[model samples]
Structure formats: structure tokens, C-alpha cells
Target: MSSSLLIALILLLSLLAYWLGCRRAVTLAQRPSADKLHSRPGYYGVLAGLWCGLPALLIVAVWHLAADPLLTRMAMHGVAAAKGVASPDQVDLLVNDMRNLVAGNVVAHEVDPLIQAAADQYVGLQRLGDLALAAVALATALGGAYVLLGRIRPALRARNQVERIVEIVLTLCSTFAVFVTVGIVLSVLFESIRFFQQIAPADFLFGLKWSPQMAIRADQAGSSGSFGAIPVLTGTFLISGIAMAIAVPLGLMSAIYLSEYAGPRFRAVVKPLLEILAGVPTVVYGFFAALVVAPAIRDLGGLAGLSVASESALAAGLVMGIMIIPFVSSLSDDVINAVPQSLRDGSYGLGATKSETIKLVVLPAALPGIVGSILLAVSRAIGETMIVVMAAGLAANLTFNPLQAVTTVTVQIVTLLVGDQEFDSPKTLAAFALGMLLFVVTLALNVAALYVVRKYREEYE
Candidate 1:
């Protein structure tokens, strides 16, 4: 049976166990007296389900984790005995070919009888492993259910035991998340180190050029790749700055008007419409920017006797700002509304007008949240790829002029890593270096934002 089907059977059995456990506990409490069961029937049922399912799931997980490596070893032995000794790369290629043969994919090289035998062995072993896994998991689950059902009694501390299991599961989930994040950072850091080994850190960081094409063959042109990132960095900052300039004021003002000044009827009508902007796909926004906004900007600039590229940072930034508007407005509106109404009343009692109360007291109290909202908008702007790629041309221009075409770090990272390329090459590894730089900058921004929020957060009694 398939593992998924087996797992589904285990879960069905667990549900049966849960029902049986509940029925047993209720049967034990037939004589309803003042002194009754220690734990509730629901707790007993949960405990039974946990006992029946968790062990079976663990068995399934262990088998899955071990099966691939064991099969690979067996396949490797058969191939080696047939093909003689081989290097690591050759072994990998042979294993890949075996896998292709097993999967019915066309093999790159000529196939032999030994390779066909190895492929057949791989398939047979996989089927045998699946059968073994199903038998073991079912037996373990049945045994766990029998033992736990036998132990179910009026005095069993089922609630405490179930709570402990829940806590452990939650802790494991949290630890898994932390480890996954650390793993990503470490993977990027290692690849970035490899990239830096080929390109000098100073040259990569401070150089004015941004070309990353390196010729693979001797006769190929443009063998020398420029690893300079200054232009890319400047373009990213310029576009982000323009986006923030457009987003912050409009979003903040919209939030302020919606939260404080607008009446319930108007807010009820407009707020959902405003938030709908967030749900619009970014590709849709990119299309809008490229087709509509870019043309309009080019025409307007021409009328004004100014030179503006058809694909300019200005168009991308404007559309990106519009896209991020809902983020800022929604968050700021919630924060503004969260400010205690008593503060406004106190300001009014001190002869302050509504605007005065808002500007002097309410905004001060909500400044931290407002700043956080703005920072979120800025991060969104920085990480944007599609709108910038479509509206702003993918030129890593150093100039800060919004009328010119520009690109971002994410765009360059995408450009460098899009095609099939060797991971060890500087051209491909540069993507990881760019990714590491973006990660570090984002981390610093988060740290600074946290410091600002904590340093200035109002302590209201």
C-alpha cells in the first residue's frame, strides 16, 4: 500500500480508538457519585488518539527518512559490481542513469544489462520497503491502542498526560522553525563565501560596474566578469526611496482619515475597498505599470520638455507604492484605533480641539506603530521584483534620477540564477552573494526598527 494510504488507515484506527476510549471511560463512571473520574472523557479520548497515532506516525517518518539512503546504497553496490570502480562524479552519473531507467526517462548514455538489473532491483526494494513499513506501523499502532485502552480508568491522569504531549509537540514545532531559518542562512552564507573566494570583497562591494557574465570557453568573448555592486545598490535604494516617498504620506493620511475623521458608514464602505488593493496580484500591478503608467509618464515628460525613459524607476516606484498602500493603511488604521479613547477625552478636557488632540496626544501615543507600518512598507518596496522588472528596465544604473531605468538586488539575483548553470561558477554563485547582502540589509532594518519601537513606545497606565 502507498504510505499515504497506510497513514490514512492509521488515522482511521486512531479515531476508532478515541471513540472506544471515551466509551470505556463513561462505562467506568456508571455509578455517578460526588467522587468521580479524575480526568474528563474528552481528555481520555485525546490520550487514546495520541497513543494510537503518534507512534505509528513516528514509525512512518523513520522509515521514510531511512529508505532512500538504504536503497541508494544497494543500487550503488549493484552498479559498481557491474561497471567496476568509478569517481564520485561518475558514480553520481551512473546512479542518475539508473534512476532514469527506473522512472522510464530516457537515459543520457547507452544502457547495459547490469544497469537494467540495478533499476529492477531498485523498484523491487522500494516495493518491499513500503510493505515492511506498512506492517510495522500498523502493528505498533494496534499495540499502542491496546495498551492505552487497557490502562484507561476513572483515576487515570489523562488530562495532564495529554497536556504534556501537546506542550512537547508545540516545542518541537518551534525548534523546527528556528532550525529551518538557521539552515537557510547557513546555506546562503556558505555559497556567498565560495563566491567571494573568486571575486575580491572590496572589488565586489565598491566597484562601479555590475556585469556578471563570464565566458566558459577560451574562445568565448567577455571572459572578465565585473563583480561591482554599487550601481545595483544605488538603483535599489533610489527606487525604494521613491516608493516610500509616495506610499508613506498617502497611506498614513488615508489611515488617519479613515480611523479618526471618517464616520462609521463611510468607513464601512471604503475600508474593504482599500484593503482589496493588497489582494491584487503583483503581476497585475506590473502589467499596469508597464503598459499604462510607463506610457503616461513618457508622454507627460515629453510634453514638459524632459527626457524620461519608457521604462523608468518612477513608473515602478509609483505602482509599487500603490501596491503597498493597503499594508500601511490597514496597519496604521488598526494602531490609531487602538489608542485609548480616554487619552483623547483628556486632551479635549484640556481645551484641545479634535485636530489638536490627534496631532499632540493620539499620534504621539501611536507613533511607534506608525513607524512600524512605514518600515513594513519600505521592506515591501525593497523586496519588490515584478513591478520593477516590468516597469523599471533591468539596468543597474548608478544615477539616482527616477526618470531613468533602474533595477534592484532581487532582479539581479533572479537574472544571475535563472538559467541552468554550474553552482560553483562565480556567475551563478553571485546570486547567493546578492541574496546574503539583501538578507543582511533586511536584518539591520528590522533591528533598527525594533530599537526605535522599544525606545519610543509609550507606557500607558
Candidate 2:
């Protein structure tokens, strides 16, 4: 009676219900005195299937959601009453241990007889609950199918019911997505508020140094960490700027050539090959940046008598730019293709050359989309963690020199939260602050890009 097994059984029963309903509808249609069937046979089948499945799935979801807490409460109550464990915190700990033991996960505390008994009880309760759940779900599915099949007459409006169910499902999915996004933003915002309470917002935002190492013990020799974000933010923008510099020109030019000049066969073959770079894992790009690009940049810098760190911003930015080129080129190519041929035809009729037509007409029409693609590429570059971590050394130096080593905000976030961390500490909470900063920065970028797009779109219109 595992949940997956119950779901499969319910689906199978729904399929049977669909077949029966369709046959019933077909039989009704064949009657000499029956009016034309209200809807298609498929609609009748679908309506029956929905009736059979939806109630059973709802029961299954509610059962699982309520079962674990109820079982935990029942088990914990017995343990507390028998053992006189009155403290709330200790009860919580014991509950966790019992659940962990039941789940076969390692428990923090050594298992005692009381915990063992409670775990066994929890398992027994879970098994009994699963059995009940299976029985109820199956009966409900069968009952729903029977009711719906009996009601499936010529005027039943099966199609309308099915469409309504689908619309409700889609609305629920959209709402769930919005809630998840809001949840993420609120969680990060709350943690960042906690972090800012510990470290002054001014110091965190405007301080020059980026050290986040806080001494655990008062007597420890380490300096209390400086949460200055300036260096980190500088490095982020530096690398992202370099990446955009490389990505935009090359990606846009390649896109223009492919869309406007290249032959159909060449464009078809080369575009996929170009887009394959996007499909390659970021880690692979990281490795290539670290092994191949970094050394090459350093060697070239040496030949030019310039100082280049072994892991420099230039190397990471260059590789990141190459990795994101497909994001820009593929999207730009599509946007360019989407530009109506009438614009180009009008330009040609006005005696404009191909280059003039593209510059004045095609590109203007596609400007908004091109800007969107660049914005996406910029976001990709900003949020890239693996390539920056691999190629750029983790030094928060406030320098604009691409030859020097620097680190990004994403790298800092990952570094700060790498291991087990007490969330209350400013050191750990700093990760949330950095995340919030990134979120805000990206939002600002989107707003700016949108403004540019709207302005240009109005001009063209």
C-alpha cells in the first residue's frame, strides 16, 4: 500500500472507468429514440476518468499530509507520558530521534528502550495508516466512477465538466508557481534582515574589505569578519562586464549572419552545433576555463610583460562568455526570424541596400527581443557559479584589472554556506544577504531592460 502503488491502482481503475463510460455512451447513441450524444465519446471517457481519479488523488494527498503529524503526535504522547519527558525542546528532540529511527536514518542520540519502542509503534501506525489510505482511496475511486457512469446520459455536459476541471488544474498550478517564488523571496528577505541586524547595513554594503570569517570563540586570534560587499560586488560586475563584452558582439554578429546572410543548409547545421555549447554542463566549462584558458591568459600576459594571476577574471569571463554565446545567438536568431518579411520588403522597395535594410528595419523590429536575449545572457553570466569558482581565484580584491584574480557574489555565497552552519550567526546569515542583493540587482537589470525595450518599441511603432 505504498503511495505510488495506490496511485497506480487508482489510475488503472480510472482507465477501466473511462472504457466503461465510453461504451455506455456509444450504446446510448445507438438507441433508436436517443437524441444525438451531447459530446464526443472521448469527452465522455475523459469526464469519467476525471471523476474516478480526482477524488481518490485528493484523499491520497490529504491522507499523507495529515498522517505523519498524527502518527508522530501519537507516538510522542506515549513516550512523554511513560518517560516523564516534559520539556518541549527535549520532546521535540525525542520525536526527531524516533522518526529518524523509523526512517532508518542515523539518529543523533543513542537509542534507548523507550525510543526503540516508540519507533516500532510509529512503524506499525504508518503501516496501518497506509492500509486504511489504500482502502479509502480505492473505494472512493470506484464510487465516483459508478456515480458518474450512471449519470452519463445524452445531456450530461461531460465536455464542459472536463474543461472546467482542466481550467481549475491549470489555475492551481499557476498559483503554486507564484507562491513558491514568493516563498523563496520572503525566506531570503527574512534571513537577510537577521544578518543586517547583526552587521550594520552601511558596513555590509559600503565596507571595502570582504572577509566573512568570524571568530567562533571570544579568545580566538582571528579578526572579527568584515562583511563589506563592495569588493565582492565589484568582482561580480567586473567579470560580468567582461563576459558581456565578449558575448554580446560575437553572439549578436553570429546571429545576424545566420539569420540574414547565411544559406539555409549552413544555418541549419551550424546553429545546432553552436547551440551545443549551451547543452554542455557548466562544470565542463569550468574545467576548460581552469585547465586551458587560465594558463593561456597568464602566459600571454607574461609575454606582454603584464602581471596576470594564474586564475584571473579575464579567463573566467572569457570562458563564461563562450558558454553563454548560445543563449544570445539562438534567441537573437529566433527573434530576427520572427521579424515580419514585410518590413524588409518595404525597405527593399524603397531602394535600400541589404545592409541598410537590416540596420534600419530588421534590427529595429528585433531590438526588443535582442535586448531581452542580452539581458538573459547577462543574468546567466552574473549567476554563473561553477565557471567563476573554477577560473577566478576566491579573492575579493576591489580592482578592475581583468588580469588580477577576483571572486563573485555567487562564489562567496557558496563559500559562506558550504558546511554545517548555525543560521543565527552573521557569518551564515551573510549568504542570505548576498542572495537578496543578487535578487535585487537582477530585478533592477530587468526593469532597466524593460524600459529600454518599451522606449524602442514605441519609436518603431
User: Which ten residues in a row are the worst by lDDT in model 2?
Assistant: 452-461
Candidate 2, residues 1-461, lDDT tens digits: the string is 78899999999999999999999999999999999988998899999999999999999999888998999887766787687888999888888888889989974566778988889988999999999899999999999999999999998888899999999999999999999999999999999999999999999999999999887667777768999999999999999999999999999999999999999999989999999999999999999999999999989989999999999999999999999999999999999998888889999999999999999999988999899999989999999999999999899999999999999999999999998887877889999999999999999989988987888773322
lDDT of 2 at 363: 90
As for model 2, its CA RMSD to the true structure in angstroms is: 2.1
**What's the distance in Å from true for residue 39, model 2?**
2.5
Task: Give the distance in Å from residue 233's predicted Cα in candidate 1 to where it truly belongs.
Answer: 0.9
Separately for all candidates shown, the number of backbone clashes (residues 3 or more apart, or on different chains) is 0, 0
Specify the highest-TM-score model's number.
Answer: 2
Please, what are the lDDT tens digits per residue for candidate 1 over residues 352-452?
99999989998889999999998888888889999999999888888988999988999999998897887978999999999999998888888888988
Q: What is the lDDT of residue 312 in candidate 1?
A: 98
